[model samples]
Target: MPKKGTRIVCFSPKSSSKSNSVTKFSAPSRFGLSPKRPSFSQSVMDRTLELAKPVITKWNPETTTFAKVTSLFHESRGEAKDFIKCVHNLQKAMHLLVTENPTSDNLAVAQNLMQISMRRLQKEFYQILSMNRAHLDPESVSTRSSRTSIQSNSTSDYDDDDEDVDEVRVAGDSIVQVEDESSLAMADLKLIAECMISSGYAKECLKIYKIIRKSIIDEGIFRLGMEKFGSFSSHKNKKKNMDWEVLDMRTKNWLDAVKVAVKTLFNGERILCDHVFAVSESIRESCFTDISKEGALILFGFPEYVVRNSSKKVPPEKVFRMLDMYTAIANYWPEIESIFSFESSLPVKSQAITSLTKISEYVRTALAEFETAIQKDNSKSIVAGGGIHHLTIDSMNYLSLLADYSNILSPILADSPGDLPESSESPAPAISRRFAQLILSLLAKLDGEAKLYRDVSISYLFLANNHQYVVVKVCTSNLKYLLGDDWLSKQEFKVTQFAANYERLAWSHVIESLPENPAAILSPENARECFKRFNASFEQAHRKQSACVVPDCKLRDDIIKVNLLRKVLPVYREFYNKYRAKMGNERSIVRFTPEDVGRYLSDLLFGNVGSRSSSSSNQSSPHSRAPQSKTSF
Candidate 1:
């Protein structure tokens, strides 16, 4: 006889006085064979189809049939695998019938049966998955075990000869253990995904991928717990076996859903920015939780199979990649801006900025985490003293990207008064002032970050460079519209001030030795002595200031020299011209003549000291001596 749950398709001989023949169809291996077949009478064939038709029809997606499938396995004293195979047999039998008799009178019956049977196959697969998932949890596993025990005790009511079948079936069920549930679900999901993808349901495949991803991520997050996110994690024992590679691979796989969604949403026609944002939000929520709370820490990176102490902080590469992913999806400002620039695109509601602002907050959090980690590392002597210099480069670039959308970001960053006007009628100048204020606030934060460096001189230099960079970037871009000329003037002035502060901190002694009045002399001897003092001071100042390093060359030439030499050089030249004639043949005592000083001053910054011979190459040209009227800011 066939296995109890195996499907048997029996066919009776055709009419017209033909031989009373019997035909039996069984899927050779997947389906068990019948040892002794009953005579295939017309009534028996009809009864077989009658019994199988309702099973196919009732096993549908309209309702949950997981319990029914579970009951079938228990009632028949068969394994879940056997029950599922029996369901597949029904689908295969109908398929065979359609292929064998496409032109026969029974074609419609065969085709409809095949259609329902295929659907039942899908529904049964999901039912099996659901059933397995139910028992995956510890509490549910205990409950299922108790329930199975009760069912086993009552198996005697079915048949005495079936006790051995029940025992074998129980042993088989035990093999579908808790640890194997996720693997089983993953296998089934891959099959379902292949079917969906081949059938042109890419979005459905993506949905199944999300389910598998979430299960993996939730388990990983639970294992890592809340401590893995910390800079100085204390749960050392708990993290000893933490597998970051596994977490990273799971994250990468989860992120692939985004590609599928983008393809589905944008494959055929022009998609609106609002719709893209909506879908991106859905992906973000599924892939990562709002990690604002303590329990969830973002873990995103390429999978690297290296063993390290788990209590050690999460690597910057992982943290940075996590932010990159967040920026790509959750903070898709570039894509949104590009689409919205087109007049044909639909307008997004202003409220969309609220969600975008939340993403902005995440970016801010990421930057903060990076700064904190760099600072902590520097403090521990594990890193260089001036690490903030490197940290600020990327942080400043990210801030610049964020600042590009100042129209929306200003409202978030600016401190608005409670009695302020409605968003629409607010004056342009007021918004400009708010944006300018926000930029200033961010610049101040950058300054604070730079101070994390132990070297105070390098700290100030860092501030000067980044501040100048931001002011220049803002002034050149569309951001200038919201940060008006006055704001630009103010930021430029601040940059000038920072440059001055840096010089004063490093150059005050160079200035102190200059003669108080070298141009006014009583006699040739006094003029020569005063000129001697002036020459000594100027040469020392030139040498010391030239050696002082400004990391950004353009900023060095532009702001530093524009502000410093505009005040110092003209006075020095006037003193030199007045005294050189008074000294006459002793003029060679002055190391740098007025014209020589002019040429030398330009190259002082580059450290190519005094080698030029052309008078036109003098650094103290009229343009250099006068106030620099056209500041780039």
Candidate 2:
């Protein structure tokens, strides 16, 4: 301290380490003998470090201490700006101290404090977003008078920040009376976004970024650094001086945020909500820009918009939503084409078709998974089975509508993997033929599933029920248009075949006692023996088959009373009446008259077997040949 111009400065150690440390410096000696004179750079560094000390020393990152940050945002007049000011000062001080003393232990403490400050700011931003989600309608924000109206209301009710604080709006959409306001707004957003990024809250940063970009677009500001619409300054009309660089940076952030949102939306575990729709719509809107116009469908909004990571597990819901979104886009092809037509672009249709192929792959994958589960343990499957059944019906209806409305399905069905013919003159039959093939494949899988049951009667009954449902749906619904008249008749024929199979499996023994030519069997001993066998067989079939489960009540009645009984009872009556008198002394052996047979048959299958008079004169059964099985003889 020999020189008169010397200055004494005290430097403190890191907050977590020794706190009170001193550093001394003196100017160059006048005698010109001292070599360690502090340089101009050293003096400036010393001043900045000293200025940062108090902030570092008093840094308290506890949530309770920072709780006021969020409170100030919600409760203060300046919104995020008020909160940003306090935390930003500390952050700036920390940065200066760290930059000056890079290797010092105190620098680490400063960095830690900076991180805490950033996280606190990010936490507050999220709170604001969550609180204001419902109020974030674009139309409301776009209206010029909305903010002033909000301000008027908020001013009367609260002492703190107005309720409508930080309501995001585009620059030109509303005229703010105050000058340099948009620039200030952008500065605050950039600082807050930096804090968000440092805090590991990429998602929060994206929300702010989206707002900024939307503002840029709404304000009619040039975002891509090009002037196709006009010079950036021309739109300003020299009314308000604006910083184009800030807009440029915000545009970059917006693009980056879109990439992040795409990856997030592809996650299956998360529900597809309004947030997802909003992000998707924004990205889709951005596609028409010169920067993305060329490969917009491929690069931003289609099947290969983002490169898929195959190793990660994608949820089915995510794929389903992607399909739904692509379908929506495809439906809007004409409109999108009209806009992009100036560029000579026809990518929407081709890209949309690619997306449909991807959707088909997902459908195939789901079906495979379902089939595998069924194969593993068919009895344990309830929800999956029922879901697939419903999916089949719904998918058919959906595909039919797609075909009828747009010619979209025609290409898909025509190019659908392998089974369909090469070309067809009629679109309806082509789609029908392909869909029928798919349904047949599903039915075959279901048939195999039914056979897994240990009870043969139940197995056949299950097949009957499913087959009947499908046939009925095809006959009555729009499916008839696609499947054609011949397809409907075939399905009906299949239904009849299933009915015969169910009867053959459940009641063949009952019908076997009737002779091929019952009139030829006239001997008393033979007729008595045949009558006894008929009664025993009928009783056995009735007891076993009655307990079988048919979940659909209407189907149960149709198969049993209307279809099977009508085909069996009249034949039973002819055999019984012819044999009743032939059993002379063994008349007591004739347990049931034709009337009793009819009543018992109806009562076993359904609850009511009609009146005795109604039963005695039976309606003729359909002349169906007995199914070819050993039990049918």
Candidate 2 residue-wise lDDT, 1-633, digit = tens = 011221111234223333233344456567876556443324434444455444422332354564544343444435445444444344444444444554555445444544555555555545544444323323223222322232233221111343222444334336653322432232233345444443344445565445533343332222332222222334445433224344334334434433322222111101111122222333323322332243234322333321121212343223344344445545655544443443334554455456556655654454344334334433433221111244444444444444343244454445443232324345444556666666666577667766666667656666666666676666656666666676666666775676667778777777777676766756777777877887777667765654454445666666667766666667766777786666665544665555555544544433222322352323211112111221111
TM-score of 1: 0.39
**Model 1 stretches with alpha carbons more than 4 Å out:** 1-257, 261-312, 316-368, 374-388, 398-463, 470-491, 502-522, 559-561, 606-633
Report lDDT (CA) for all predictions. Answer: 0.43, 0.45
**lDDT minimum window of 10 residues, candidate 1:** 267-276
lDDT of 2: 0.45
**Candidate 1 lDDT over residue span 1-633, tens digit each:** 111221223333224354335556554545465545443333233443555556645544345566344433223423433333333334344434544533433334434544444444444444544566543332323222332232234222112334433344355466656534432333333333333322233343344334533453344344533224333244354556466576565446535632332232121011211111122334323222211111211221111111222223555345434433344444444443332333322232122243345434543444455545544544222113222344445544554554465544454434441122234244554435544444544555666676665645446655776676776667666666665565567667776776667667654543544455645555767666665665666666665455334545676876346755665556666776676665667544655555555544555443333333343423433222322232221
lDDT of 1: 0.43
Winning candidate number (TM-score): 2
- Which candidate achieves the best lDDT against the true structure? 2
Each candidate: RMSD:
19.1, 21.3
